[model samples]
Target chain A: MRIERNGAIAALHGHCRVEDAETLAALLWEGSVTTLDLSGCDSLHGAVVQAILAFQPSVVGSPGDEFLKQHLVPALARRATAD
Target chain B: MIDELLAQFLIEGREQALEAGADLAALQRGPADPARLDRCFRAVHTLKGSADLLGLTPMGRVLHAAEDVLGRLRGGQGEGGDFSVLLEVADQVERWLDDLDTVGVLPESASAASQALIARLAGDGAAPQVAAADDWDGASAFPGRAGVAIRYRPRADGYFAGDDPIAIIKAVPDLAQLRVSLAEPVADPALYDPFRCTLVIEALSTAALPAVETALRLVRDQVALATLRAAEAFAPAGVEVETARRTLRIDAARVDQLADLSDQLVVAKGGLIELAAQAERGGDGQALGQALRAKQAELDRLVAALHTTVGQARMTPLAPLLGRFPRLVREIAATLGKPAALEIEGGEVEVDKAVVDGLFEPLLHLLRNALDHGVERPEARTAAGKPAQALVRLSARTVGDQAVIEVVDDGAGVDPARVRDRAVARGLIDATSAEAMSDAALVDLIFLPGFSTAETVSSVSGRGVGMDAVRAAVTRLGGRVEIDSRPGLGTTVRLALPIRMVLAKLLVVESAGERFGLPLDGVAEIARVPADRIFPIRAGRAFVLRDEVVPLVDLAQALGAEAGPSSDRVVVAGVGGEPVGFAVDAVVERIDAVVRPMAGLLAGARGVSGSTLTADGSVMLVLDLAELLA
Candidate 1:
């Protein structure tokens, strides 16, 4: 588990390919995240992505992966587009 | 191929065209606000472009003629000429489109309707009497239509279900834009398996809701679809620009999650509070305890801020619900031959979005009852020394933590005797029961199931359901509805509801060794007294509190729980303006809990409103104050 905090915002930095969803859900439940970051690291467990979708925190810094940045980030937060 | 494009326009073009349809409604009502006229004109311009593109001569001709009429209205033609002709042309165009939907082409008789409507819309002066009630101001009037955002994902086993995301997107009609992204994480090429489909497809379209829903009907369960107000669509329509604020639509579940997180903070704070009490007695870590207390205070501020920000997201103005009323009442008045005009105020009052959504149906029932049953006819009103046009005032305001919405009308009020006679005539109650019931109780009989006062069963409000459904719906939302009327004066229905139902603070009390949550707002006091202090009253025990005599009942007996040994602790709950005390075994600590109504069989149980959990994971029932007291 890789976690970084800037005030109330939280970002999962570096590689995180394997994670139990409940652990992340518990952590997210403990501390609310207004803006979540998904950059530098690319691999995400399927359940983690489900959690992120359910949480609906704004995604930032998507490591130049155009498909991820365009589709997943925009899907996560409708307002987090380049516009 | 040209036919296919027309089919696409039939769906997508018509959806886009509805954006300007309200301007036509506004045009018929009175002088067209310049901006509103422009909106209507612009809509036709876009539709004409698409129709011409599809080589549909009939659609193009109608739209072009309508555009000319809108252009004249924009150039100060002064709202005097017939605008209903344009509305008819638009409706005919829609009918032609609907024909295309079913038969794959326009109807054969479309040419005649097109010719007649085009000539009238172009001011050939064959104007008929305008219906006059067709007034809608576009988005400015009731623009609560939010854009539906959808995300689609095909599961690994989606192949078994015959679901393919690409084929689904390709099949979608009126797709404005589309994007496909990988649902897979970054991995080595060796482990990449394309056969296991994992892609999230995101799309935005101006297509109507039902069309998109039909397109994705096969795999709707595999995706997320949410209605959102697109931020960019607010193109500064230029009315009330100073107070405009851009909005982002978040799902209600997300806001509820934030509230849950905030609730977790409260639960954690409860533990910290207990620790602080321990440290204060120990004295060894007094300095550390003070520092922790200060940090807890800081945490309290941050959590509170989190709470308020999330709360604001769930709130919406009451105007949209209120705005739709004038148009509705107008139609009903014309139908019933009553000259009733509706006046709405305090449209700016902000309430929880859920509250606003749930409010419309109940208010509709009451307003229909008022119009069909309460309001007197024009001649009847004149004879009674009242205005010919009955005035129905629908207003809203915030009173403390509750929202008070009243539907007040000046007309013939409800007669309790008549209601009683109707109840007996309808066999809803026996004559003996009617004799024994008070006037107020007889009036309340209108809310009983299958009870309606409309003697002749009017065409408008004569749906078989009664006000009982209204009361049941409101009670489900933890709200109270009240009715009051004088013999000849008028009837007023007042509804009081909490701002939101998710989170509430309750004074924890124990009855018969079981914990119950008493809403803190309803609890005026918690008193500890000797058992000898209790005195017998006519039907129940009486306790003196603050120099006022209060009726007391055993909380355990009221809830039908096992009666344990009665203790000295009593929780005083407010009933209207009077005080009533509920005797319990003990008053525990206060808690902020998520008060949710019970589910399944427990839901039908009386006196128990809902259930919430303590931090220790024990389930506790929250008592219904009104039900228990009654």
Candidate 2:
């Protein structure tokens, strides 16, 4: 995986559980997270969506779990790559 | 001081007289027996003596007149047609005594009313023939001569005023013997009117037939005279037989003292038994011989039985306690401006004297509460389509060695919803907790201190003291308070009190490495559990018994005792209906011990009722399970 540091861009990664997604969301709220990839992550459930809404209400994604990779991660990655 | 106690005794005495008089009045519907008539007179005589000591002069005079008239009736006085007046006199004396009981002194009005009743009886002018007629029995007992007897009954009103009927019988010439019989008034002192007399008299006279006729003729309106033939008077006679027939009357205090002394003797006998057992177990030849040779032990056994019999004879019915309620309800109704009827059943149930004495205040509170709060206003009842007059019923009965007193009222019942709202408003219960509670649980909250849902505070009730104090009073005696109410129907409060508190049974258990007793009523079951049966469901949580998850707290951890694990029973029980499981070091055998209340500072401690001395002389603390569970 190729990743950008503090500005939020990241390459594809493996699967993560719903609980891990929640932990990731909490970390993103603290401004330490920039971008992520989930090419192999699988166990993530609606809890990840809940964690996002709970921590960063303004953040959104397309309708399904795929939306997390297509929109959320890329959105962060673009911001990081530009930075 | 003796006089005051005597007055108190008289207060009860007049009541008994009235009850007896009522029986006589009922008997008047038929022929009356002379022995029963004599027994009735003694009851009145006792009333007179006690009343006199208390300086209740008017009441004393009333009873004296009654005693005289009843004497004539026993002497075979004229036809027993005039007993109605004697019953009426008893009714009046009971009323006066009742008045003295309530106001602490009889008012002047009572004396004057009594005088009027006596005057009415005197005007009926019953002859003073009791003593004269009794003379005939005495004279005829001598031989073949026929003797004349006279009887007298005063009027129902003022039977004591200026009427020395007994003195009159004494005045008859040539009288051989005289006896006055008085019967107790049948009126309940609570409902007695102070102007009635209940007396009958009989007199014996032996003179020429003309002389007997002439004496009867002098007070024809006041006395009834009859000629008793010699055979009727002398038929049954013998000194030893008469002595055997007589009952020896003794003081109640003496009987009580004998009973107390007997109890001590029994305890000593038990000690002797222990000593004998020790002698038998050990091959102690001298000790065993001494134990066998003790004749004093046999004497003690006989004395103990005698004392027991004397003590039992002192026991009267619970009627006296139940008797006070009718008058109480009457007074409460008048004060509350409500129409109410109090019905008491099983008044004849017998209870220990000490229990009856302690029951007064608790029963009073229950009755007052029912009257002041439980019953609704007349209009409320009318609107609800119930009887305008509400009914309050008190029933008491003995079950095994326990007495159950039920105070029930058919009136407005307690509303749990209102109680819940009040509790939330008062911050006693949070809204969520209140919502989660059942109606029964919510209603029970009323017994908590300072909890009331009363819309208004009246002098009679609703100042927020609530039933907490009442519950404390009952539990202090190791009794339970149970309340069941249905809105718009009625409420019943049942108090389950031990027949006597001297002896108690408790379950001994070791909690926190210390021996403690859990009252038997609170112990549900004791079960042994394996270590593997317990499992942690949460970080600091575990379940103890079957699948139903019980929050586990180590006895040592919860009570700050030494926590050393060993195989022991996981005692499972519910306090106040909440499931609780606590481990104990061991469950000692059940035992019977006298419940000794904890002393001074420890008396108020939670979860401990008192301490008891075990057979081995070790102190065991009695745990109050309800308080612990709460």
Candidate 3:
């Protein structure tokens, strides 16, 4: 789900598609877009990962940003599950 | 192949039979006149013949059934009970006709119903001979045929009904060497129905028109019978005087064209005088044109008088629109379960034939609104110290070129405050705006789209659309809508519509050389203010116009045009009496012409309504006052 200040809103099925991630990156940089909601997305592709890392979003451990944090820290969850 | 045409003929025959039956049913209550009965019998008989000619057994069977019943009624053999049955048959047939009208085909389902009706009428068997007595026997006799020519249009249904139309023509008494022409038949027999009544008879009869009309008794609506004296047609031919007064009947469009020609010729007479004066002064052609100009002016007067008489001949009474309403009121009263009576006055008021067609929908909506909202329920009315029955009055009259139709009802009136409250609730207007609104301004809010004051929505009223829709429809035709309401009394919705909507007078004003028109009524006043006389205030601007302080807005900036130098003066205007001043570059010419609307994207633009051409043949934009004020 994505909600923008300029009245455009989009809902994704599950994980953000690679094409959708690139489009969101372009829209976010336009600055007119004030709101962003990306929940339930699992896989973060390499290009999208690099784009997100380059333009750092103020990510908090909120339900809406949970999916983004999960993709951000893959190793911690991998070790916890092994113990 | 013929079956489809037969079906078509049958459908039309059924429709004609039903219309005649309805007319008969309406005429039955009024003065018992033989002419009305004759009209009824003729419509049914025409349908019957058309059905038979098309060999539409089922359709012929039904019309034949109706014809027998109506024939007996016309002959005074049976009681009025048969009229009720015939009306039902007419209703069923009319329904079938409507289906055919919409889809171009009648469903097979109605055949059984038609058969049932035919069986009932068939059981009656023989029809009594109807009385053929004339109402006004020998009343205005048409003189001899020396200068006269007549034309007859045989019933459109006559050919399909197997009626030998030529025989009907031969039946006309004293008919002289008549030229007959058959109207072309429909092509594509597979799609064409042999039963469909497509035949017409165009005849030039020397007989008198009224006498022929008397002979035409049954098929009057379906027939175009006219008698033109030869002199009338020759009048516009620019021939000799006596020859111009001889007989010939021309179409109405040609008459209007002649009027335009005469007006142009009158102007040409002025030019002729100027030329003749110059010719005489130059000592040239004095003997050639001694009284030519005088003769031309006299000829112009004679032509003008002839044009006036011809135009008057085309003026038909408002009877047709008036005639349909009593029955409409009866039907609507039955449907709504209310005892409402329609009192129509001044129905003799004549209007352009075109205006009558546009009048129906607006009048219908007004009547429906009166029934649904204005008229109170029986018990409620009696409890409120009012009469149990509601009176719905429809009156039409000519006030100049405009016709004013007043639909007045004796019921509860609309409350302006309630309308204001609704506007506030809908968020259509701000709280401060609502508070500042005048009663007239508040009353005008009822015409806003999606505004309804009814407590509960019914199929008839509320539904978030009512008077506003009527206002929009009326205004689209270049008319004005006014509402007068007295709480606890009644509401009268007055529609002042012009005889024709094609042309109007617009006051042209300019802002930065770009011309725009403020519909004359929307412009309250236009004044010139010296650069020192005008003063401006913060937040909202006001200027004195005819002793009243009216708020002003710069037109160029308001319309989002590039800003230019400010002017001290402005055009103060508003719709529905909300005063707002719009500053323009200059006040230009006032023009009268046909307004042509802009297409697509341009039509939706703010502050611009439509465009029209000036006398100099230049386009001027019509300003949208409401949008500018908003």
Q: Can you write out model 1's per-residue Cα lDDT over B86-174, one digit (the tens) per residue? A: 65556556666777778876676667556745654544334321111112122222133334444666666654455545556555665
Can you tell me which runs of candidate 3 are displaced by over 4 Å?
Answer: A1-83, B1-106, B110-284, B302-316, B500-630
Native contacts, share recovered per candidate: 0.00, 0.00, 0.00
Q: Give lDDT for model 1.
A: 0.66
Please give me the DockQ of candidate 2 compared with the native complex.
0.00
Error of 3 at B523 (Å): 30
**What TM-score number comes out for model 3?**
0.38
lDDT of 3 at B559: 76
* Residue ranges of candidate 1 with Cα displaced over 4 Å: A1-83, B1-293, B503-630
User: For this target, which candidate reaches the highest TM-score against the unseen true structure?
Assistant: 3
lDDT of 3 by residue, B308-381 (tens): 65655444556666655665566556666777898999788765544554455567668877887888887888
Global CA lDDT of candidate 2, please?
Answer: 0.60
For model 1, name the residue pairs that clash: none
DockQ of each: 0.02, 0.00, 0.00
Candidate 3, residue B600: lDDT: 95
TM-score of each: 0.37, 0.36, 0.38
Q: On residues B1-630, what C-alpha lDDT tens digit does candidate 2 reach at each position?
A: 544355445545655565555445443433566545655665565566456546678877777667666655655675653554565566566666666668767777666545544544443433233322322232223234345555655544423354434344445667665433333432343333223344454555776434664554545545545443443322122100111111133457767777677777777678678776787678688866776557466666668777566655544466767776676577677778889999998887765554565565567667878988899999999999999898999998888977889999998888888889888898888999999998889988877755766787564444433576566556655566788998898999998876656546676777666888777766667777667777776664456555677755565555445775664566666766765666777776565556978899988887778897653345678877666545
